[model samples]
Structure formats: C-alpha cells, structure tokens
Target chain A: MQKILNDKLVVTADIVLRIILYLSIVASIFFLGKMLLGPVLGITEYKSGLKTPIEFSVNEQGTATFGSNQTVPVNIEHAKGLFQIDRPVPKTLMVVFFLLNLIFFGLILWVIHSLWMIVQSVRQKNPFIVLNGRRLHIIAFSMIGIELIQGLANLIKMLYLEPRLNFETIIVHSKIHVSIHVIIAGLVILVIAEAFRIGVELKEEHHFTV
Target chain B: MSIRINLDVMMARRKISLGELAEQVGITQANLSILKTEKAKAVRFTTLEAVCRVLDCQPGDILEFIADEKNENE
Candidate 1:
C-alpha cells in the first residue's frame, strides 16, 4: 500500500511539473513574440499611471462623505518625459530589459527541466544516482541565478533608466525589494543537493560493498 | 588491500562448484562470486561462518593477510 501511494505521488508530481514546464514554454514564446513585435506594434510604451487616494469622512451612523461632491479642479502633471519611448536610448534599454526577462524565463525553464529529470529518476526507483545529485545542484544554482538576475533587472530600472528619464517623482517610489524567502529556499535546495551528493556516494559504496 | 579471499582455491580443493557452494552456504552465487573475486568490501560474520561450514575449513584457511610491497620496502 505504501508502494502504491509512493507511485501515485510520483505520478502526480511528474504531471504537475510537466504542466508547469508546458506553461513556462508557452509564456516564454509569448514574451519572445512580444519582444520581437513590440516596437513595430507600438507596444513598447510602458505606462504607469498615477493614482490619487480618495478622501472621505465617516460619521457615527456609518455614513461616509466624499471630500469632493462636485468636479474638482486639480493640477495634473504629465509624465510624458518620464518614459520617452520615442528616444533611441530608452528604446534600446527597454529591448535589453525584455531580453533579460527572456533569459530569466529560460533559466526558470532549465530549473524545471532539471527537477523533471530528478522526478524521472525517482520514478525509476533510482533517485540516489550521481546524475540526480548533479541535477539538484543545477536547480539550486539556477534558482540563485534567477534571483540575482531579477535583482539586477530591478536595480537597472530604478537606478539607470529612472534617472535617464529624469523621473525624480517615480524614482522616489521605486525600491529594490529582494525576496528573502527565495534566497532561503535556494539555500535549502543547495543543502538538499549536498545531501543528495552524500546519498549518491553512500549508494555507490553500498552497491560496491556487496 | 592485501587481505585476500582464498574462496576459489578452497572450492577447488573441496571439488565444489560455485553454484553448489553458494547453495550450501545459503547465499546468492553473485555474492559468492564477489567474495571469490576479492571485490567485497567486508564479509558478514554469518556469511563467513556459513562459507567456512560449507567448505569444511577454518576462517584463516580461506582468508589471508599479505604485507603490502610498499610497507615491506619501507
């Protein structure tokens, strides 16, 4: 019964990984298409509209009154100069950014492929092979690479692109928020890869012992 | 590296085939082959005892310790 349950789990995991792999491929293709046709199709403009918070007052009866009952005359700042898509420099930078995104997605696909290989090994009832250990290591390192790329991409956008566009207002709001959980998860995977390496060595020793 | 198994020599002396010795010793022929080929990392006490019993020999008779040439030279 335990064997049956294990088999079922393996199958389910394999199916899920395969689905994710297919989805990643499709998304990558979509991104590639977007990158290729973005300039020609006038989709290169990355617009971030400003949002104003609505002010309201609440009474004891839970009745709310909006600050503006009529059409309010407000000074609107045009952010056209912030993202000058017509400029050659920003256009090239945006293309490069999209290319970096493609590379990031490619790395993700590679990680998924490595994990798929590991699941295949498990399904074969030989998960402790040296190849699986190597695959785990690849997955761990790829995850770290993905995180680094994401951070670098954000930094480039915030530091270089934002300043080049003279967007002081937008730069104040832009911040690089690195996910600690992702780094921790990568470290955990690295440890698991190390364990797999030890397991492979032990398995080889056990095989030769007899 | 010099601790050698004389299982093949003992089996030859006893006029017993590998299969027969393995069957009498209650071990797989493949494992017995590993012992004979001196490829096994270590032998279990129970396996050694069974092998000795099947061959009608002492443990020392089937196992030999030879000094390494490097150690001897040193």
Candidate 2:
C-alpha cells in the first residue's frame, strides 16, 4: 500500500516545541520568584466571632454583626520562633519545599538554554542531525518527567498528608494554572520526539544505497 | 561494504571544476568538495543525476564497488 503524509506537519511540530521551551522558561521564572521572596512575606490571620453574647431567649433569632477590626493577644511563650507565621506551615518542610522548587527551577532554566541551542542547530540545518536532536530531546523530554513527577508529589501531599497534619483546609502550592505548564511540557516533549525521529531519518536518507 | 564514489574521477575526466559542478548540481561548493573527498556519508540520486548529466557520464561511472581491504567481520 502507498502511504502519503504531509511531512511539513513534522516541521511545524518542531516549531511548536521551540515555543513550548519559552513557555517552560516563563514557568521556571515564576516558581523561582516565589521561592526566593516567599520567606519574607509575613502572614496574618483574620478571625471573627460573635461580639454579642448568645441570648437565653429572644422572639427573633439572634443576628450577629462583626465590627470593622478585632485584635487578639500574642501568645509568645507558647511558640518558639523569631517571626513565626500564625498559619499552619511547618518551618522545616516549607524550607525543604523552597529548596526543591529552586532545584527544579534551575532544571527548567537548563532546559530553556538547551532549547535555544537546539533551535540554533535546527536553523543552521546541521548535518549531524541525529546528534543534535538526541541532545535536544533528552533535555526537552526530561523536563516533562520533572514537572509531572513534582506536580504529582505536590498534589499527593496536599490531598493525603495535609489532613493528617492537623492543618486547615487544603492550601498551598496547588495552582490551577500550573497544569497548563505540565500539559505544555508534555506536548512540547512529544513534538520534540517526533521531530527528532523525522530529522534523523531525513539526515540518513539517500536516493541510493552503497 | 566496499562501494566507492567515482565523482572525483568523472569530474577529472570531464575537466569540470568542483565549484562549477556544485553550482550546476544546486549544492554548495563545500558540500561538493566533501563528496569529492569521500567524506560525505551518502548522496542523493537527484544530485548524482545532475552531476552525471553535466559530466556526460553514467551513475555507474560516478560510483564504484570494490573488494574489502579487511575481513567483513573485522
């Protein structure tokens, strides 16, 4: 059977992978910024309770009103920290998360730089297509693994462990927007893989055999 | 495994300069030089046809197969 394919689609997919590399860079920058500045950002809690005491009996059910501002006393001796966050974040774990975020952020940056080199290789139409593509796809697809695994870990921690920690309702590090990055990374890796495969074939193909 | 490119031989016989041959074949002079030096891994039939036509030679004249210098396993 004869098979026909618009081979240019493969080229377009490679272009899309280049774009995805840029997208990954933007994601890395966001995570890096959060990790760096998140430490200093002070935390405050807002809680309001009935200012009016419960009545023994009333014709109408009691209606509660919250004043503009309410202040609570500081319980300093009960805790041990220089500037403790009133929130439920564990100090050591938060620091670990911060460091891991930096590590992955650096990995993302490395992938971005590699993407630039791959684009250069593609643009120059390098003769050694297999070697060029092998390096590029390794970095490109490895990023997918990194982002997906870390994202899954974050989700699992939020879901299963957060409750066991006696913490408030699930919070922290689970951004809806982050999935856009995961999907983008996966798609970009797939595109790079296809491009690499075709590019090697093209480089190797000749009208006749030896 | 012992096939060889006779492009240089044909080009010499036809007195066609490598630069002129590359220009006729729609490829770079550097690439033509590589092919003449037997440094290229493979060649396209379209390129071979152009060279053959320009040099008044056949594909067989531009390419050759010889016995191995060493054993096949080696």
Candidate 3:
C-alpha cells in the first residue's frame, strides 16, 4: 500500500499545521509579553474582568402560588447568571492570574510544537518513531496541565472575590468547573501514544527479523 | 538471549563467503549479517530452510541454546 503521507492532502495538511503552529507561538509570545511587562512600563490598565454566576432572590411575593410555595417577583436590574464584573483588580491577585495564564499559554505552545513534530515525522514516512510517541505523551500531559491551570485560576479568582463583595439579593459565586471532554481528549492522546510506542517496538522487531 | 545464532561458525565451516551465502539464500547481505551477528529478533521458516539448504546443514548447526549464567545463579 502507498504511504498516506505521500499523498498531496497530507503534504498540504502538514504545511497548514506548521503555519498554524508558528503563528500561534508568535501571537502567544506577543500577548504574554505585553501582559507581563506592560504593567511595569505603566502602559497597561489595571482593570480586569471577572465572570461569575449569580443567584437571584426577591423579597416581594407574587399572586401566583404553587404547592406550599409562593412565587416571588424577581427584578434583574443588572446582568444575570455568569455575569462579568469589570473593575480594577488587586495587583497580587492580578499577578497570580497572569502567571497562571502564562503557564497555560506555555502548555498550549508545547501542544502545538508536539503536534507539528508529529506531523513532520509523518511527512518523513517515519511515523512510528520513539520521539513521536514521546511527543504525544508531552501533548497529553500538556493538555491536562492546561485544564488544571485553568481550574486553579478560576478557583483563585473566586476565593479572592467571594468575601470582598456584599450583595443583598444577588449571590456572586464561582465554581471550579472541570471539563471532562478535555480530560478525555487528553486520555485519548495518551492511548494513541501507547499505540505509537507499541508500533515502534513492533517495527523494530520486524526490522531485526531475518 | 539464551538462543544464539551460530551462523558465523557454520559459514566458516562451509567456507562460504557472506556475500555468496546471502545471494544464494535470496536475501540482502545486511540482513544476513544481522543473522550472522546474532542480532536477529526472529528467523522465518522459509529463511531458515533457505539458509540450511545453502549451508547444507541442519537447523541445529546454525542455532544453539546456551544457559544464562544469571538464570543459573538465581
């Protein structure tokens, strides 16, 4: 059978992925540098946006009544659940959030780099190399790291803002949400890495068989 | 490995050069070298038959099983 990588489609895909990887790296570096150094230069604003869920409760009861419960008329003067608060954030918390964002960005770069390397290997018709397996492993772990850092950032933001704000009817709360799909995607990559490892071993064995 | 390929000794006994043997056996010299150097992970029945026919020897002459010293000690 002809190698799939020899096809024009695969060549095009490899070129496209390489371009995307380079662009993502350049853009991430530029944004991360601006976020990290702009404050020191006194050019960046201190305003940060925080998005959290809000529970609404009303004191006035409506005429409609359910079984053992009265309907309360709720007025939403502001945004509803999962609303954003745009204000100045404390420097310490902002710095910590920025650092977390930086780590997440680095993980994203690693994932793209690994994917590009894997595509390059495929283009070379040596897809079952040990290095590709290691790259896949790196990609898997980096995905998990990105998820964990995002969750940590969300938790930190919630913890920092929960006690400081006081509201009569609206409860601003943030919960650390774990994305199961991302974790599963990472696990699928891990399984692909194992398959690549086994393929490499089998290829080596076949190569030596005489 | 405990199972070793004594192909070099057999080739020497038969006075057949590596190039000649590889050509007669219908395989590449690099692959024949791997078998001769005991670096082969496996031997196909067809390849073993061809090598035995070329060397005019039995399978026992090319392959030998030696006890591992570590296993014996354990």
Candidate 4:
C-alpha cells in the first residue's frame, strides 16, 4: 500500500493541504487588517451574510416582504416560510460577528495545519512520530472547539438582535444549534489519536529492541 | 534501566574492536555500539549467543542487573 500510494496520492494530498493552510493564513491576516482599518476609514456599516431561524407570517398569497424591501419568493412546496437572510448590521455587531468568523477560520486552519503535518510525515515515511499523535489530538480538539464557537456565536447574535431589529413579517428565533455529527467526528479523531500514540510507542519499542 | 550491558567490559577483556566484533557477530557496528553503551532495550538470544561465541564468555559476563533505588523503594 505504501509503495503504491505514498509516491503520488499522499504527496499530492500534502501539497494541497499545505496550499490551503497558507491561503487561509493569508486570508486571516487580510481579514484582521480590514477589520482594524475599516472603522478608521469611516466605514461603520457591517455588511455580511447570516443564517438564522425565523418565525414568519405570510399574506393571502403566501408571500412575505422582508425588512430590506425585498420580496422573498415563496417556494411552491413550502409556501409559508423563507430561509435566506441578508442584512446590514451595526458596527459593534459586525465586529463581534467578524471576530467569530475569524476564530472559526482560524480553527479550520489549525485542523488543516495538523492534517498537513501528518501527511508530510507520511510522505517522509515516518508517520509514527510521537508529535503526529499530538497533532491529531489538536485536530480533534479544534474540531470540537469550532462547533462550540459556532453554536455560541449563533446564540449570541440571535439574542443580541432579537429586540433591536424590527421586521415587517418575520421574527428571528433565538435558537442555539450544534451539529452532532461534527462532535462525533471530533470524538472519533480523539480515539484515533490515542491509537496513533500507542502505535508510536510500539514503534519505539521495536526500534530499541535490537 | 536495572539491566546493564557489560559488552564493553567483555570486549575489553577479549581485546576485540567494535567493528571486528560486529562483523564476526553478523551485526552492524552501530547496533554493537548501542549494546556496548547500554542503550539497547533488549538483546535477542541469537545476538547474545553470537557475542558469547565470539568473546568466549558466558552471557552473564556481558549482562548485569543492578537494582535501582526507585525500584527498591517501590
């Protein structure tokens, strides 16, 4: 397996992940610079996209006019509700929202960085290094942390905007949601990290068994 | 480790160089150096037999066990 896959597939994967890691780092730096400079440049309106739960009341034709003077096209299958949200928020809310997104991006970059290191180790034919196990543990924890921040950010945004924003036919619901599959994936990675640690120990034992 | 390798002592007594002994024992000089310096985790019976045959000494002449204070306390 190593003979066939190690030369092409693993190297390609390592390169791809490395590229993504570098790009994400650059993007994060750009985002931070923009956030820091935007207010100083007299740009206070925070224009961004968000998805949230809503309580909607449709008219006789089963269509609603959103706060932004836009008509939401009601689907024939689900004529009573609309899912998409687009709004310009306050500067403070934008700062919090952008910070949360930046943190989420950072966590994703962390997972990518760890994955790239592990793949690089495999490319070098030394995947059982003790540090690789720690990298896997980092990836696992970062995954869980990403989900937690997502849920918390969503809840905070919902609660903060609940009383302030006035919509014509829709009310945003303050609901906190987390993806169970992502948490389960984090737990699985943790188990894999433990197994990798044990494998590294066994490899060390074999190395010194001369 | 409690188990100590006395390979250097045995080699000295036999007047055998590391390269010469390693070649005679069909092992690498680096591995022989590890064994001589007590850095090895375990010795195979084959390697021990070859070392003994080359040095004309028993296995006990090359390996010694000194009880650790930590182990004694435990």
What are the per-candidate TM-scores when only chain A is compared? Answer: 0.72, 0.43, 0.76, 0.75
lDDT of 2 at A163: 44
Residues A50-95, candidate 1: write the lDDT tens digits.
1111112222222344576744444433222223334334456656
TM-scores vs. true structure, each candidate: 0.67, 0.46, 0.77, 0.79
Better of 2 and 4 by TM-score: 4
Q: Which stretches of candidate 1 lie over 4 Å from their true place?
A: A1-6, A29-103, A167-173, A207-210, B1-6, B37-39, B57-74
Model 3: runs farther than 4 Å from truth? A1-6, A39-95, A166-170
Which residue pairs overlap in candidate 2's backbone? Answer: none
- What would the per-residue lDDT of candidate 2 be over residues A1-210, giving only the tens digit for each residue? 122243354456567777877787787776555544554232333111101111121123233445766544433222211112334444455555566666666667666666666666655566356666666676766677566746654554455443443324322232311456766876787787778778677656641121
Estimate, for each residue in A46-105, the C-alpha lDDT of model 3 and write its tens digit. 335455554444344336556787675654444436655565566676677678878888
Docking class of 1: acceptable
What is each candidate's fraction of native interface contacts (fnat)?
0.45, 0.09, 0.95, 0.64
* Models sorted by lDDT, best on top: 3, 4, 1, 2
Taking all chains together, the TM-score of candidate 1 against the true structure is: 0.67
Q: How many clashes in each candidate?
A: 0, 0, 0, 0
Report the Cα lDDT for residue A178, model 2.
40
Model 1 chain A lDDT-worst window of ten: A48-57
lDDT of 3 at B11: 88
Model 3 achieves a DockQ score of 0.80
Ranking by DockQ: 3, 4, 1, 2
Kindly give the stretch of ten consecutive residues in candidate 1 chain B with the minimal lDDT sum: B34-43
